[model samples]
Target: MKTQIFYFSSTGNSLCVARDIGNAIGGEVELIAIPGALKAPRPVTASAIGIVFPVYMWGLPALVRRFVEQLQIPASTYVFAVATCGGNAAGTLAQLRTLLEKKGILLALGEVIRMPGNYTPMYGAESERSQKKRFAKEKIAIRRIAPLIADRKAGKVDCGTWLGRRLLSGFVYNGGMKQVPASDVKFRSTEPCNGCGLCVKVCPVGNIVLVEGHPRWQHHCEQCMACLQWCPQVAIEFGGRTQGRRRYHHPECSASDFVW
Candidate 1:
């Protein structure tokens, strides 16, 4: 049975889980990039389909929400969704399940993998070390869940409560709907930016553009943090706020790790 994995990742955490599942099952993986970015074609025949992404504002990221609305999944394909979150999965899985059902697909499994939270706007650099420790712990836990995902097991995970959903949805839509405030979306340059333009090339939302050999965010960002997290020189910063912040990418994933 052919299985396909589709994912959306900003800091590469979701991509990490997707890659591990792909490796474990030895099935095809497709990345559902943010809108207006390159993407791969959906497979015509697959016994199982997987959707992986990080939770934003206790729900799906805006880019992933748009992608799910536009996605065309086959019927009765044994669909599954995996979410990576700093806390609980919240209502993200329920949201995906509803969206897929609207498209005539059944979500067979929904799993949330706890990972280090990277929302720099809400959480600052003070917790950087603790976040890394949580990430390490999550990685260890992922090993146990990987097998269940590979076997298409549908586990009864918590979906949070009505109030929790309302609160998260409100925060995400009102506070995180667009580019984070300038004070929040800070970036600075170190000595390592070689003007490679890789950051510009890999941005799914065209948030970063090169200016005089340095990359600058033109605002209108999705807060994916791909540039800062994926920069090779580690030169990018969000003002001085993110200085000394730990960059995170998927363990075995890179910019080219997922496409479309």
Candidate 2:
């Protein structure tokens, strides 16, 4: 059966998981980038459609949320969603199911993969040793769950219990979104920036634009961190707050890499 993997990633954690699943299944991987970005629609007729993304502020990333609301999926397609999170996925899976079901699509399965915490303000800098441990755990979890999705398993995918949802929602949305100081969201640039414009080219939301030979964020960012994380020269930084911070992306992925 033909399968397509769709995803939106910031720090590349979600992208890594999406790529691994696509490689394991030997399926075509498609990127469901944000609106106004370069992307090809998934051919969903009689095929398996997989969505992999990160949970932001207890919900989908603003861009991913908009993408799903506007997405037109085939009625007969088999749908599955996988979320990568530092801790909890919040209500992402349930929200995705509700949206897709309205379009007459059925959710076959859902999985959550844990990765290094990238929400800098909230999680801080996890040690390389800790990140290694988390990645190893996630690899095992992905292996266990990958086959279940490939087999087309049908069952209620439990992300967590009701209490878990409530707690996670409070932490991700209230603690991370509402309460986090704006100063924490600031970013910086390093000397490596050659002003190549790749960040502008790859930004799905047009959040970054080249200004005077350097990329400048116009305040109305989705906080997807795509520009900061995907800079080819490692030039983008989160201002003084993230200065000297360790940058991360998927091991084999790069700034100009396109999944589809």
Candidate 3:
């Protein structure tokens, strides 16, 4: 079946997973970057459709949620979703199922793949040992998931309590989403900034601009941390927390891979 995979990734973790799945499941696998697709979501008539993105605050990213909400999926198309996360997925799949149901799309598959954590505002990158462990697990999970997707498997998997999902969705996830728009203001470029304007180009939301040859945020941030994580000189910081912390991008993905 022809497959169209829609993916959003800041540090390239989700992007790598999407590509791996496409490679395994033979066909005309089209990988569409969610940020670019969000600009003009046209109807998709693929034999199968997939959405892959990172879990944010135990739920979907604000932009990812909106993209699914607005996406036009044909009723007959088989649909699946994969949530790549550092920790528990909580209600991410449940949240996505609800959104897709509203559009008359039954989510045929919902699963999570654990990956190294990159929520730098909260913590530093994982240690090399920890990351290696996670990546190994991720590869196994993808290998199993890709065939299921290729065969059009229908299933759902969720690992969280009803009460826990409610609390996280209502408090943590929702509150975290509110912070996304203003969070860009917290980003600061240190002395290492070279006016290269890479941040402006790397931002998925077009939220960064050059002011006096340094990057300035437009307050419409998605909190993906692309600009900060991909900065060549290790210059970008989120408030006082990320100045000296290690940055991480999926080792399997490169800057050119993210340009889509």
Candidate 4:
């Protein structure tokens, strides 16, 4: 059976999960970057489809939600999802189930995978020692999750702690969503930026461009922080909060791994 894994990752946590799942499924599999996928319209169908992405503000990333809404998927396809997050899954999978339900499609398996996080607004990047522990556990999770997906399991997948957090998550998530587009206004590069234009290249939404030897954010930002996390010179910062703090990208993933 053919499998198409559609993923969105700012720092590669979700990409790592998507890649692992693909390898474990062990058949014809292709990984598609969600941002790049949205650019060129085409028919997308497979025996199975996986939606793997990070949850933001306890919900779906802006672009990932749009992809789920617009993707041309068939009702019969075995649809599975893995939401990679720092702590809580919190109705993120439920939100996905709702979207698929609207199209008369079923989300066969929805699982949450915890990983090292990179949301700078909330805190500093995690330590290398801590990230290694998470990676080890993540491997074990993929080992267990792959067969269920391969066997085409059908049901809602949730962490025991996730159920209670949804009410609060939903409230904060909805309110936070409104600020996503203009949130980029808070990001500015420091003197270290030398017009490398790498930020422009790494921005998932193409929300950045170079003007006078510096990267500028357009209002359509996904708040993925790709430019900041991937910047080689460490020049990018979010409203001064990220200054002199660590940046994180999955150790297993590189700047070239993402398509856009």
- In order of listing, the candidates' clash counts read 9, 5, 0, 0
Q: Give the per-residue lDDT digits (tens) of candidate 3, residues 106-130.
A: 8998879989888898888988898
Q: How far is candidate 3 from the true structure (C-alpha RMSD, Å)?
A: 1.4
How many clashing residue pairs, candidate 2? 5
| TM-score for predicted model 4 compared with the true structure | 0.95
The segments of candidate 1 whose C-alpha lies over 4 angstroms from its true place after superposition are 26-40, 121-153, 179-192, 254-260
How high is each candidate's TM-score?
A: 0.78, 0.80, 0.96, 0.95
**1 against 3, candidate with superior lDDT:** 3
Report lDDT per candidate: 0.68, 0.68, 0.85, 0.86
- Give the C-alpha lDDT of model 1: 0.68
The number of the candidate with the highest lDDT is 4
Model 4 C-alpha lDDT per residue in residues 1-260, reported as the tens digit of each score? 88999999989999999999999988889899898888874467678999999988888898988998898877788999999999877888888888889989888888888898788866888888999999999999999888888888775666334543556457788888999999899999899899988889888888898999999899999898889899999999898578878889998899888647
lDDT of candidate 2?
Answer: 0.68
Instruction: Show the lowest summed lDDT stretch of 10 residues, model 2.
Output: 176-185
State the lDDT of candidate 2 residue by residue for 35-142, as single tens digits.
433244444443777778888766666566666766777776777888888887767687677777787777888877778767653434577788888889878977
Q: How far does residue 163 in candidate 3 sit from its true spot (Å)?
A: 2.7
Worst 10 residues of 3 by lDDT: 155-164
Would you give me the overall lDDT of model 3? 0.85
Quantify how close model 1 is to the true structure by its C-alpha RMSD in Å.
3.8
Clashes of 4: 0
Give the TM-score (vs. native) of candidate 2. Answer: 0.80
